[model samples]
Target: MYSQEETLRSTIDKSLKVIRLYDWLLNLYVLDFFVDNHWTKLPLSWQECFQNITPQDLGNILSEVPTKHVLPLSFISLIKAVKSLSLPRDKISNKNKIGLLLSEDICNGHPRLKNLFLKHVKLKKRHEICLMSKVVSGVAVESKCDAVVDFGSGLGHLVRVLAYNNNLYAAGIECQSQLTEEARSVQLVHAYRAALERILVDYDPKLKHAPVRNIKHSDTMTFQQYSTQALSRLNIPLPACFARGEADLRQWRRVVTLYTLRLALAPLVETVILLDRVLYILEHGLSCEIHPVFDPKLSPRNHIIVGKRL
Candidate 1:
């Protein structure tokens, strides 16, 4: 008979195996990094978080992990446990940093689900982003919009995807200086790589007919070029202008983590202003559409609001 601890350990081992297999297929480097740097270092609390996950939940996670699903289920249990303890804000200070770093790396590595970081909650599968983006784009087209604004643009993943793939004029509003700087840096790096690749493909005759490599390189190159142009045209000025006289916005509930709260507040404020602005545009007989993206998992509060003006 397996002891309770042994049972939990076995379950975790199996689940991790599945996760590793999935990561191997989609982005092995992420798996290597997680295993090498953080897997063993996970705190007891974190381990318990995974340990407590229901078998059914574990199975669901296993099924989706291989497909590169972006759902928050993997860590949702832990985040909830941490929130329940009413830990000091500083205790969980690194949570946002870890999440942001992980999501950013995942975005850079996975071409299929690059915008996973922008989502407030984790998604169950990669197709969810496609589904959500399609819905939002449809709403925008129906509204006949000229530009889209993505609030709380984590690593600017959604902005990059929409702008690069759809050729839409989009802007991402982020409050964290570190994240903003990183986003800008990623865009620059991707652009330079893309420019180099284009030069290579155009001049390297021996490698011109390598379809598989060429296609992969071309896709990345195209995405990078699109990202660079979109980022440049966005004109995202630093330290987004906030409402006057609200410097000590600390009055806002310090729930979850400061990073989480800050990310949350930016969109909430942006949504109110955006909705009103869109309403006014509609009232003025302007052709435009407003589409909002929301994440159901990261607390019922996760939301992404976009207003498109035709």
Candidate 2:
């Protein structure tokens, strides 16, 4: 395992190189896909490379979120370029050194509080809160922290878990008043439900179980449908190239290929950001570590930046 300094230096070097190498791809706005004829920017060889790729193949690029993909022999050099520049997003185990310190087994949340607080949370969010609450609580306990302050505390899910489940004093700071109000509203529901449980012995079946199914775009969704849903969510209008009925299939394949390439670069970007934070802590003579506490496929931003002044 490399030391933190070694890891940080290596990551920064690679990140800079990657950003410089793909500066054009990185800077081009998705909104300008058709307006600027982004497809025309690709070299003819690159365009021809993606010509025969099918929509299902394009969907596979997204659905798998590939740690590794089987590339054609012809594209071996392309794979080499990406692999050499991209930081590996390998599943981190306790045996591996992500930071100087090792992570412990996450303590389970309080069962009663879990029932009260987890109703509105989605599956991915539930997974995150369940794991992250324990990690944050463990850090607070280790540092003998008087209170936990959560920044960007959307709906206060983690804060609630830390405060109620872990028996820690926790407060959430949210820049949006709507979310703050909603969190208060949710807190009341928890209080009311807890009161009901004591007085009426109420049982909520929904709280006990949640059903989940893995859906793949390649299996169930058409490429157009997938692209439409993605852009609609982001409030981006369909690019004119795609909006036309005779949209080139080659352009669609290129869009998927380029998007997957960007996704592959994400870990390098995250490493740069998290390490910068770690360096700031180290510079101040404080202890800091980044723990990969969540499943990366489920929570892409899985690394938790942990620091303590003591």
Looking at model 1, the pairs that clash are: 70-123, 71-122, 71-123, 72-122, 144-310, 145-309, 145-310, 146-309
Give the per-residue lDDT digits (tens) of candidate 2, residues 1-310: 9977667777777667756666666676443353355666755665665556665665565344452445554344544545565434454666333332123222244555545575677767877777777677787778887588889998888887677667888899888777534432212112111222221111233322121122234455544464454334333343442434234333555555655555655555666777777877877888787777766767777777787786
Count of backbone clashes, every candidate in sequence: 8, 0
> Which candidate's TM-score is highest?
2
Q: For model 2, what is the C-alpha lDDT against the true structure?
A: 0.56
Candidate 2 lowest-lDDT run of ten: 188-197
Q: Per-residue CA lDDT of candidate 1, range 1-310, in tens? A: 9843344345445434443433422231221221133222444444444433444455454323443333355345433332332112221232123233334333335565644444543443323343345555666677776578878775666666566655578799988777534232222222222332333343453532222212223444444343244334333331232221122122222111222312322322333454455555555555544332323343233333343444
lDDT of 1 at 45: 47
Off by over 4 Å in 1: 1-132, 180-299, 302-310
User: Model 2, which residues run further than 4 Å from truth?
Assistant: 1-3, 55-114, 180-251
> By lDDT, who's the top model here?
2
Q: How much is 203 displaced in model 2, in angstroms?
A: 62
- Candidate 2 TM-score, true structure as reference: 0.64
